[model samples]
Target chain A: MIPVCKEIRKEILKISNASGHGHIPTCFSIVEIMYAVYSNMKHYPKNPLWEERDVFLLSKGHAALGHYCTLAKLGYFDIKRVYSFGSFMSDFGCHADRFKVPGIEASTGSLGHGIGLAVGMALAFKLKKTDRRVFVVIGDGESNEGTIWEAVMVATNVGLDNLTIIYDNNMSHGRGLQIRNPAERFRAFSCEVVEVDGHDIDALGPEIAKRGNKVRVVVANTVKGYGCKTFVQDQYAWHRRSPNDSELEMLLRELDEETI
Target chain B: MDLSLHDERIVMILGDVSVYLFKDFNDKYPNRLFNMGICENTLISVVAGLSSQGLVPFVHTIAPFVTERSFEQIKLDMCYNKFGGNIVSCGASFDYAWDGATHHCYTDLAILRLLPGIEVIQPGSYKELDVLLRSQYDNGNTTYFRLSDHPHEIDLPVQFGKGAVIKDIGAEITVMTAGPLLGNVLEACRDLPVNLIYFHTIKPIDRELVARYSRTKILVIHDAFGLYEAICEVPNLRVSYHGLSDEFCGWYGAVHDIRRKLGLDPKSLKEFIKNTIEKTGS
Candidate 1:
């Protein structure tokens, strides 16, 4: 793992431990993907509303803790402020709200919603005749929703070349509606499809940079918990569990590959 | 259509409804109008995205499909996110009466008004549709326009959230109704000694007007469920709804057919109003 991505995972563990609220396994899966997208997206942390900034939406909003940590790492806000996650009156909730946080282009929590918003935004940029693009991350598990395909079809039909969808194929769908062949399905929808090892920053950067002739989808094959074997081995158990003090220490050590 | 001409940022996404009505607008602005299949949920989400990017979006479809099926998209994507857009729906109540009970839509206004920041407008005529669309389209709040195929020819004053008083008779019974049914309601109340109130805007519902006439027993007559629920929001009133039974309107033919069957037609409504006046001892 890249130092920053590792640090983000560590921060996720710490924040979830402190706050008693975390979609820990889900957040762990997307750390590298989020980092790559943010690093590649044209956003000014200081001026998140910069007229020319490209937009990013987390469609699988359960992974909000990962999104906040990534934004903080990217200088959107102090990383310390995220400790207040899920608290009353704190801007940061388990699900990110766009109005409450900088760099959150659209507030999303429901499955299959963010992709449609991203499509509309991409279509908007096309209507405006601007170079601004929209990138949204959707979980493979969330693909169970029929609206997901509806949005993808709409995006492809409208020729949203400026839109890039990152499908976190973390196999959280292993138990339920598995998107066994996401790349083929996207290609069938007329999207430019690319498969990549989600945990590798180098592999993701290039794919995230490419805008296709139609809607582009990066099928990031990821484990639900990438850095720590404890989480990776029993992901469903840890999917939404915030680590206790002892568990946090062990997870932190495991995140460092000390006892893996 | 004028909205797109006046504002370059306006975009329309349709769920395969009202395509021909917007023919000229699409011709003028090809890139701005998208007939995005019959995906009501996706259309709404797309509209929210357009709104988020400072582009005004209008998603049009049938009433039940857009407002009922995609309720969450409206609640979260549009209202909760504060990404404003215009949701223009056709087939008000039983406008698709020939299409049967599956196509009837009366819950749209009632359910939509429950969302915090949504502006629900049931345009009774072409004038209300034009005026309200011009005023509320770019206000950066999700606005729902419920349009009927059969618009009543009454061109009364229209506003975004204010209700209009047609007759301020000091009669004990106040006949309150909204949208296209106002014409039938008006006709029904003409020979009767009762006050009449009409509303084009349902949400942020004309509270002041409803409150002022709170002393009088308000008879909410409409082809839908929302106008009564909205007026009742003013609190503690002898208000009752005379629309939309607890079952699907199983019988259907046309808007007028359904209206006549439901006693919303002029003659039936007049009889009902007369009975109400007589019952109230006015």
Candidate 2:
């Protein structure tokens, strides 16, 4: 993992531990995918509200911290607000806040809905003959939702190649069981699947650069926590756990005391 | 009442007979229309997509196919989204009695009414329906208007958005009828002096109207689902509801046979209303 990515995951763990409100395992699973997307965004933090800006919807909305941390790191919002997450009336908390947050495209609390909405945005862009693309990151567990498959079928039927779908296939889900391989499942949905080590930004950067008209699925294989040694291999517990003094010391030491 | 003048932005999603019923509108406004053959889920989703793009969609399909078949799509894509569009579901209230269970939609109202922000309408007559079609297009939100396959001409000066309160208000009892069942209620009311009121709209239910008129006597009659659904709202009102009970409708039959089996016969319905009023008064 890059030094910066490692630093951010520790920060997320700190805030989530303090607030006791984060989908950490899922959030940690998609760090590189988030990094890949926000970096390649044509109209990111500069023009967040630009109608023609490429849209990135976190369809598996539970893993919202990945997107939020990436957005803040990319200078979309202030990093200090991350500590206020999950507080009373705090817009920056758990699920992506569409109304208050600048980068979020839509409010998605329910599973299986974001992909459908993303497909609509993509189709509309296509009809307008625009160069903008829509990227959606979904969870392998969320793939079991019927609406996701419904949307997958529709995207394929309509030949929506411009939309890119990434699956954070960290192998584990809410019930603490690893899911079926996302690459195989997504391939069954007729999407062009790309398997990549989610922690490797080099692989992600090259793959994201190759955009096509058909929907692309990037199956990001990742450990829930890549940077902190305590979480690197422990998928279930490390996904969401408070850092005690020792763990915090280890995490902060890994980041070399960088506040950012 | 002329739909062509105001429905300029209306995107008609066609299914079953809707393609034939609104063929002219579809052809003239091809950009604002689409045909999803036999795929009601996609039909609703497509219209929902169009509405998101700022095109006001008026999705059309037979009631059974649109409501029963693609219920999840309607619940999620349209009602949940609270997108502005018109769901003009035709063949409402067993109007497709000949087509059987796959085509019977007695539970559409019962199901759709559960969705918040959805305004429901069941115009008593064709003239009333035409006015509602125009008003709904202008007034945005998710709306489901029940239309009959059998069209008949009936003249009334009163607009149908507001419930039609019969003038002269003679009898002590008020029979609240909705959709095609209003025709049956009106027919039953002719020989009797019982007063008549029609519920043209269902959601954001005219509670004030229902409360005021429900003082003396109340009897709600309509297609099985529509009537039961409306009655469930005013449970405390001294009202008698007449419709099909919650059960699987087995097979297709003539409209009259279905009505008779469901005890929606004019004679039985009128008698039920009269008896309820008499019992309430005594």
Candidate 3:
């Protein structure tokens, strides 16, 4: 799992570097969470739109590089398609487009929309009497949106036990805004809240699998730019900027030396 | 009736604004209906989700809240993602006149028409509304039905993407209008030598019909914004527009008074049409 995370991070960096634009820090923060989901969730890569498949939606859609790389690695499409990240007339835009890309459940880039979309899907699954789970990964800053709380209330009121929300609590947003306590905020909306180390696969895997009769929110605490040497500690500088040549070389060197 | 009887996949979601209007629907299918409490933005996204799962979801609310407040959700989650849902918005233009500018939606058509692949409908009569609702339900696309409370008595069959000729007397001047304002337009052009045309489907706008009237003088009157402007986009047509300007109305009064003030009443429209005919020398 660690090696796969490393490879996904490498692919994300490559795409961002090549495009010269992306939300690298945001993508880096949620790499492990996404990796855990793709590895553990029941999905068919060949038949991306299979009805009985578990769905994953990136609510914080600007961090689309992470999802695109993960879907490519999962054999949903050719890995070479990631090279057309920001090219003109390319399917892979900076944001996730469900119509263009296979394995994308919903097209999300605007914040606070994914949770409500997932709730609707969960309601559909419940109505259809299916056991398919809907997983949504949202950014902490994205949680500041009122639509998220609206979805939270609906999810709780409807008792969507099949729905799970994994919040990437990266602690920093654009313009250096910090979320004080994301788990407590989610718990106020009447959901089973669990805190876990976002980078720890051993801890995250079990937490994500735990489900009960109510909606569950797993707040995964993480850092912005998890693996990069210069960006790991910096709060907001690397949120949208791509690395230059020297910085890319340094990031690659740091990733090589880090023990998995 | 066909929507509730035949199609079991149809689910109605409300934004706490249309419960009284849908009481009979609620009584029949209580389990299928959901009142999502005044959160317009969340209502749109949830409908998109339901649509994604192959169920036809219809959302009802006031015009401005659904179109303007939740504009991003309608654009991204519904239309951009190609999820099919029906947005049934009541209170077209200043129908909620005394409720002030917050409730009055003058630009719902304009904002929704900008999005690609979304069918916008404005039914002028209860008969047109009935046919349009069933047709849009069967068609299954991202459609916006701008509903008005003022139902006019018309005898035209409701067809999607086709303009209905309410009164065609072989005149050289054509007057096109939509929504409940069709009643006022009909009264205004009753004595004038002009053909009356009505449009319920605004987005897949019947461009062919508009072009067919290019040789004649065209006068378009709408209650809401941008339908006339969109029709005028048909190249090289001699068109004159009569509707609300691209400005907010801070005046609060009855619907009739507001219409008179905006020069949208029947008498005002009659004067405008007479002037237009004389100017065009048709």
Candidate 4:
């Protein structure tokens, strides 16, 4: 089977060239997180509307470009369709459009929202005695939103072990510098928190496996722009900046030379 | 009616449907309806979650509790997400007539109208409410219907989405009202020389009708804070926002008494229009 993360990132970079879109760094940060969810989960491909499929919410919606590409790479839709991202009458906008996309569980972008929805879903599954799992990814900066913590309290208090939340600790956001402390807070709210290197796919597998029927948090420490050379190590500005031609060339070269 | 159809219903998250609406239903089908408490934020979020799973949920609560209390939830969960469901918000402007300021819900139309791709309806009567309820179910859409605790009783077509003219146009200025104020305007029409225009939906404000029918000035009769305040984009036309000011209403009294004290009596309405015409000389 094709490695989901690598394939998705490649397609994402291709779409970035067409729209010259920003948020490349944010998209890059969550690539593996999206990969981990899509790859391991028992999802309904033929019928995305199937009720029993595991629910995945991209709470840190700026990372949706990664989700779009991941959905494409996983054979959810044709990869060429992503070329129309952020275009006129395009279903694939910067944020995940739940109505148009077959697999996205929620439409998101406004932070601090998805976790609450996920919590509700988890509660529903628990009460109904269903095996459906709910996964939500939140940006480190997105943790600042009060609603996220509100849901965390509700989820933990309700003992919703069916939920797993991934925090993309890329250390950046709209107003800049996401607070680097969700461990103590998430723990205070009674959630099991696991800090790991976000780029390490191997580290992710074990951490996810370790979460046995407990509401868990995977704090993925990743650089904002992880893959390209010039943009790879950069922060803040690269979070949503459209690449210049020179930057694009450098990024392509960096990808071409890399051996994953 | 088949109990399953009513049981297979959805909540109007950003409005107030009484606890009785479900409590009465629960008496018949105990497991059917859910009263999500007063947690407006969680309530709307849960409604959206239910909608995602293809569960038809009818969320009901007061306007301030539903809209202001859980506005972000409504925006992110229901509107921006584009989830097709019904949000029936009762007690539009004067629903809180005596409950005072915090109880009044006049700002819903102004704020909800700003969101893209949301269908808003203010049903002027019981017949209109039935029509709206049917439309939301028949055509799966993200819709909001504003209702009054005491809506006007009008014998009209079941078709919604259009405003109804309640009075003839023999006067200069039009006194536009919704909810309880419709009856108030009609009562005052007995003594005054002003025409009445009843606006059903406030979000997509019928500019053409307002501009056509109202020649001199327009006086909006509401019980809560009027559109000129921070909540809604007040119309730019020659309009006056009449409602309880920024003060909260905790006084326990009849709604009519409260209306009279707030200068919302039919006599006051006539005088307000007369003063406007005299001052403008249009």
Q: Tell how far residue B106 is off in model 4, in angstroms.
A: 2.4
Show where candidate 3 strays beyond 4 Å.
A174-177
Off by over 4 Å in 1: A258-260
Q: Compared with the true structure, what per-residue lDDT tens digits does model 4 show for residues B1-282?
A: 243555444323322246655555567654445554445677677667767665565567777777777777878897777555667776666566667667777677667766776676777678777766776653545677777777666565444545566676566666676544666667766555666677665555556666665354666776654222321233456667776666655565666777777778878866766677677664
Best-fitting candidate, measured by lDDT? 1
Q: Residues A1-260, candidate 4: write the lDDT tens digits.
A: 13466566667777887887748878877887777776666686778877778888998887878888888777788878888988889888888888898788898888888887887677667646788888889987888777777677767866778889988887774355556477777887888989988888888767754545568898888877667655655665676777666766777667666522
Of candidate 3 chain B, the 10-residue stretch with the lowest lDDT total is B132-141
Tell me model 4's lDDT, rounded to 2 decimals. 0.70
Quote the positional error of residue B2 for candidate 1 in Å: 2.9
**In candidate 3, what are the lDDT values of residues A118-218, reduced to their tens digit?**
99999888877889999999888898788988998988887899999999988765445566777787788889999999998888988888777889999
lDDT winner, 1 or 3: 1
Candidate achieving higher lDDT, 2 or 4:
2
Better of 1 and 4 by lDDT: 1
Better of 2 and 3 by TM-score: 3
RMSD of candidate 3 to the truth, in angstroms, is: 2.0
RMSD of each: 1.3, 4.1, 2.0, 5.1
Q: Can you list the residue pairs that collide in candidate 1?
A: none
* Per-residue alpha-carbon lDDT of candidate 2 for residues A1-260, written as tens digits (9 for 90 to 100): 67667656776877776777777667766887888887786765866887668888888887777677888888888878878787898878677767677787766666767777777666666655678788888877777676677677777766788788887776656454445666787788888889988878999977776786568888887766555555655666765566666766776675454322
* Tens-digit lDDT string for candidate 3 (B71-127): 999998888888879999988888889899888988889889889889888888888
**What is the lDDT ranking, best to worst?**
1, 3, 2, 4
Candidate 2 chain B: worst-modelled 10 consecutive residues by lDDT: B151-160
Model 4: DockQ vs. true structure: 0.34
RMSD of 2: 4.1
| Candidate 1 lDDT score relative to the true structure | 0.90
| Candidate 3 vs candidate 4, TM-score winner | 3
